[model samples]
Target: MEHNLSKHISGKFNQDLENVRNHVLAMGGLVEQQLNSALDAVSANDSEQARQVEKDDYKVNAMEVSIDEECTRIIAKRQPAASDLRLVVAIAKTIADLERIGDEARRIAQVALDSFSKEQQDLLVMIDNMGRQVSKMLHDVLDAFARMDVEAAFKVHKEDAKVDREYEALIRQIMTYMMEDPRSIPKIMALVWSVRSLERIGDRCQNIAEYVIYFVKGKDIRHISQEDIEKDILKL
Candidate 1:
């Protein structure tokens, strides 16, 4: 009789874990959609689309709270140990990152609402490219998390460096333009802010990939150097 009860409890715990995992994935899907909408709005300079993206942020925020609550409940009730506990913790962290990415998307949407001069249109093109790159990174990292693929996560981490270089190049170009014509400063500044937000989104995606590594290997590689991270991942 005791053995049967233990088995039943174990099954219930597994179900709860699966439920939370699904919730996180759902939240990730919503976040990805929000990002793409915001980027598209900016590229097309569509205020209505940008407004919709801004309004939808509330849904993402709500999902973050819901997922966190569910994770907390599972931890409190199940008292999961070892790998199970790691999974819960990683899910919670990933949700937090996703919520921040949502915030960044909203900021990008706000940029779309701003008035841009014809001269600034070319700059928006560069920002659009950055947005698309980060959006792809986010999509890839989420897939890695879903599959628990450490190798894929590592590849995503490397992609972040490319995004960083692109961001830097964009900033340099904008600065050059500002120096050439101070009158374009305001528009250029807005583009700079938008690019920065996209860069942050990339950072968040990288962080999520790191969490995937932690989930699979049970290692905390948050602050380690890239050299060390590469070595550690290779060892796996």
Candidate 2:
């Protein structure tokens, strides 16, 4: 009878953990959609689409709150140890990153409402490319989390450098345009803000990748050198 009760408890705990994992994935999906929509708004310079993206941010915020409460409840009820504890901790941290990413997306949408001339449209192409790259990184990191694949997470981490380079290149191009034509300053400044938000979204995606590694290896690799991270990944 005691063994049967122990099995029942363990099964219940597993179910609860799975439930939380599913919720986190669902939240991630919503965040990804919000990001893509915001990027679309920027590409089209559509105020209505931007406003809709801003409104969608509330749903992301609500999911963050709900997921956090569920994690706290699981901790209090199950008193999980070891891997189970790590799972909950990683989920909580990832949710926080996702919420911040959503905020960045909303900022990008706000920038989209600004008017730009036809000459400035060429500049937007670069921003659109950057957004697409970061969107792919976000999608890949979420997949890594779902599969618990540390290798995939590491790939996403490495991809962040590319996003950073793209941002730098865009900045240089914008500065050149600003120097050549002072009249475009206002619109160029708005594009700068939008790209900055896109750059931040890339950073947030990297954070999610780090959480994926933590969930798989039970190791915290934040603030460490790439060399050290590579070494750790090799061990697994």
* Model 2 regions more than 4 Å off: 1-10
Model 2 lDDT, residue 43, Cα: 89
The TM-score between candidate 1 and the true structure equals 0.93
TM-score of each: 0.93, 0.92
Model 1 lowest lDDT segment of ten: 1-10
Error of 1 at 107 (Å): 0.5
Each candidate's clash count: 0, 0
lDDT score of residue 224 within candidate 2: 88
Give the per-residue lDDT of model 1 (tens digit) for 72-124.
99988989887778788889999999999999999998888987878778888
Candidate 1, RMSD to the unseen true structure: 4.9
Off by over 4 Å in 1: 1-10
Q: What residue pairs clash in candidate 1, if any at all?
A: none
Worst 10 residues of 2 by lDDT: 1-10
